[model samples]
Target chain A: MLAEGRIWKFGDDIDTDLIIPARFLNVSEASALARNCFADLRPDFAASVRSGDILVAGNNFGCGSSREHAPLAIKAAGIAVIIARSFARIFYRNAFNIGLPLIESAEASEGLAEGEKSRVDLSAGTILRISDGARFTAKPVPDFMAGIIRAGGLVPYTIERIKAGS
Target chain B: MPMTITEKILAAHSEKEVLSPGDLVQVKVDMALANDITAPIAIKVFGEIGRESVFHRDKVALVADHFVPNKDIASAEQVRIARDFARRHKITHYYEGGDVGIEHVLLPEKGLVLPGQVVIGADSHTCTYGGLGAFSTGVGSTDLGVIMATGEIWLKAPPTIRVNYEGRLNPFVGGKDLILHLIGMIGVEGALYSALEFGGAVIEAMPMYQRLTMANMAIEAGGKNGIVEPDEITKAFVKERGPEAEAGAVYYRSDPDAVYERVITVNVSDFGPQVAFPHSPANIRDISESGTVLLDQVFIGSCTNGSLEDLRDAASVLKGHRAARDIRLIVIPGSPRIYMEAIREGIIETFMEAGAVIGPPCCGPCLGGHMGILASGERALATTNRNFIGRMGHPESEVYLGNPFVAAASAVLGRIGAPGEL
Candidate 1:
């Protein structure tokens, strides 16, 4: 099924320190993490977030460090998808491994205003911006990756496969 | 088709022993690591993975850094969990702050890292070991957790990019300067998922410590690992490290006619000190471009640049002069070994005499958890990697990245100055 959410804008190179600082790593409880997501970058990020919001960012989003806390913290904080111009290699895998859907669109970041509604068709590989009627093509998540995400993260997905004796 | 160093190594390490770009290779990992910040989660995931024994008990390293001395009660508990896991697993190398400094520095000092090894750690700066010619990369806790269980990871053998550096470096221009210069040339996305190889006369001339500085920051350019083929310098470093380390001293070279996705040639003599401004490591500026940073604080530490050589360089700038009255200068040695060496060489005393507060060899303040963090709206220059906004303490504080000389010089001037200016 296609998923959609309102857009939250962030600039390029939004690092792990901003997404989920090291100070918070000690607490692995996802709910507590949900409160401090983007504590450094945008102080109000936690309170401002909706249950199914999408983030559109500039190039090199999720750069700096391999802290999975960044993605987990975001996913726990109610972010459904993140559409960036590009993604850091390790962060990309971390997000997908944990079932936090991320899309990369060439112009999803450009012409994007905060709070603008975004309609994403995961299968079609298109992100439709409702306000400006802008349609941007996204780098399609591969079928294998899609299956993993649908299974809700690698751990549970792995468990399901093992349970099915596959 | 010619093979790049990264491709060649992955090919040698893979099960099929023949790899192309994007092939998921599940090879036996030489080592797996995680520090204080990452270990707690890694332990949790390791438990959840339902594997009591790791693939290789002797292939794991756990270090307690990032918030040593237990910044808070919670941080102490993370260190506790890490210690318990290390003991229970009978890890090959388990280090806590007493003798351990940063994981990057401590691993090499303890002779745990070797050349040509493929090392993965939960911490991103795990790339620091690339200086040893190892294909070291960073992964998330879940990935590390899986490795902790199965001792293998699925990875695409990346393409290689060789940097043939030529010419002699200017005395003032150190390895940190060279890496910064490369990042400035390549920008952030230049080497995504690629192995970076260092070759040429310049690399051959570089000391092990200096070469480590260059390889450690390959991540800044988005590369998987920045590696230098082990040579005489590498041989000496490993030889002194003992026999166990000798096993890991392998080097990979591209086939003479090997084709590369990208080849960046750098003339070492042409570069100078580089500073990353604003919020990005890739937002680098040459020291020759702008001479001053109006900095109020100067931090000198991180696994990447916090070392004996790094502190020695900072001491050179702070030898006779005291830090400026308005500026706060803090120096953190990378490891306990480096810390002891600096103390013995009087480098630590020189920093103290010059008004630089010497902190224990840990990742403090560099990550801005504790130590010399910045206040809101204040500007500081640091010798560590990454200056993303709010990385060091106050969210409103500004961070500028440069070599140790620039940081020391900034401490003396109460503002950043080009090399030797202080």
Candidate 2:
């Protein structure tokens, strides 16, 4: 449950259209969306992003569209987790439903800078700045949501639940 | 303890004795829907889950309005996937080809959504059903995929925000203006995770179509859903829509002592048609204050304002005058049904004679998919929801959101003027 990665920082209201424009919504494949992640606002994002990278952003990340392409693209692009000051309600649920972890930490969102190395301890809900060693606590994922993430998304979670029988 | 309308509906659907704000509950879904843009992903996830079949065949609906005619190869592939899934699963309400329409508009029109239903769709404007007193909300494709497999969803009940509307609206000012004014008062994320319950004399007296339009924009203010308690008007409409609608209807009203997170009152008597300028739906201004802003295109369509009444209102403004020289006027009916009705009412002919280009019933330009994308630096006025940057076309292009009256008058004037100005 611990993730160590370099940070990719963004500002407020990073909308889904910017993450994956409706123009690219033709295919449902995560990789297709990953290729165009941040295509509008940050064209170089797809080419430069490496696996296990972490995304940090200010408030209202993933606003606008109800499309899950934003989080799917980010996860497929190999971003380990997203840390934001706040997130749009639908996006937050989508991220978890798809097994993409997100942490809400105003302190971490303000403390972390672009391309900085960071270690996120999901179990402890704490993030450590690699360079400065400053640590900030993130809100813990709700117990049920954590269960869904553990099962690797809602689909798998639902499958497990169905197999268990009420 | 008194419960809000949302809480009451959620509790009923979950079969729980009661529910309060922030309580986590698993609720049985009455209806689940997705469009071409979202259905592909949900279908993929549904397959990955390895479920034998959908939880309930009749409770699911899929539509292909977003890219109905297939804007491109990718969109065509997506539509094909959705079509294949629908046919393979034997979904009851699969809509495509001549029958296709925007899911939100089409669902209520066909009487699929009813009062007290806990409906969910993979589109933000699913809140439009709340106008019918249903507890409908938008979710993601992943959530929809799960809903397809198991007709249940986990939701944290949201606190209610009551919006009280009073006074009369000026001519040409309607639901679009009222919603714009509310979004202006509260920023885009003002009602985050909150249910917006619209009430008071004005909304009660408003027509059903206008109520749908008003509820459609609830997401613009980041509300989880928007609802109006069912009354005689709603009951009459439901009864006429037929026995299926009335049989499914289960109306619930908020208790008098129900607690609300916030209460905002809007006085509409003195208001004019308000416009949401470029980049955000919350950046609103009265039409009179935003004078002489020339337009490259004027679009009237989308689930937001493409109903028959919306077309009639626009036709009323464009009856004699033609669109300004060099300006393009694009009109799209919300559905094939609405298209036929508009034609029967002579609304389409008025639009054509007035120099407007009539497109088929599909959602394209509203999301910058196709049909009328803006060029760089171009300015277009539209009756659709969401005036976000690049919403209609090029990022540099701008979209001004207004009601049908403002959109039609602006088309005739080739500027951002009001119907009164014409």
Please identify model 2 stretches exceeding 4 Å from their true place.
Answer: none
For candidate 1, the per-residue lDDT at A16 reads 79
TM-scores of chain B, in order: 0.96, 0.99
Report per-prediction Cα RMSD to one decimal.
2.2, 1.2
TM-score of 2: 0.98
For model 1, the stretches where C-alpha displacement exceeds 4 angstroms are A129-135, A157-166
Interface Cα root-mean-square deviation for all models? 1.6, 1.1
Q: What tens-digit string does per-residue lDDT give for candidate 1 at B1-422?
A: 66766666666666765567777777667889998887888888878767668778788888888788788888898899989888887886888858678888888877787877788999887878888777788988888887887767768778778888888787578778888888888887788888778888888888888788888888888888888877788889999998877776776666788776778889877767778887777788877676556778889888878878888888887888898898888888988788888989999899899788888878888778888778899988888888877888788888888888888877888876875665
- Predicted candidate 2 versus true structure: per-residue lDDT over B191-289, tens digit per residue: 888999999999998888888888898888888999999998899879978998899899999999999999999999867899999888889998878
Give me the candidate number with maximum lDDT: 2
* Shift in Å, residue B358, candidate 2: 0.8
RMSD of 2: 1.2
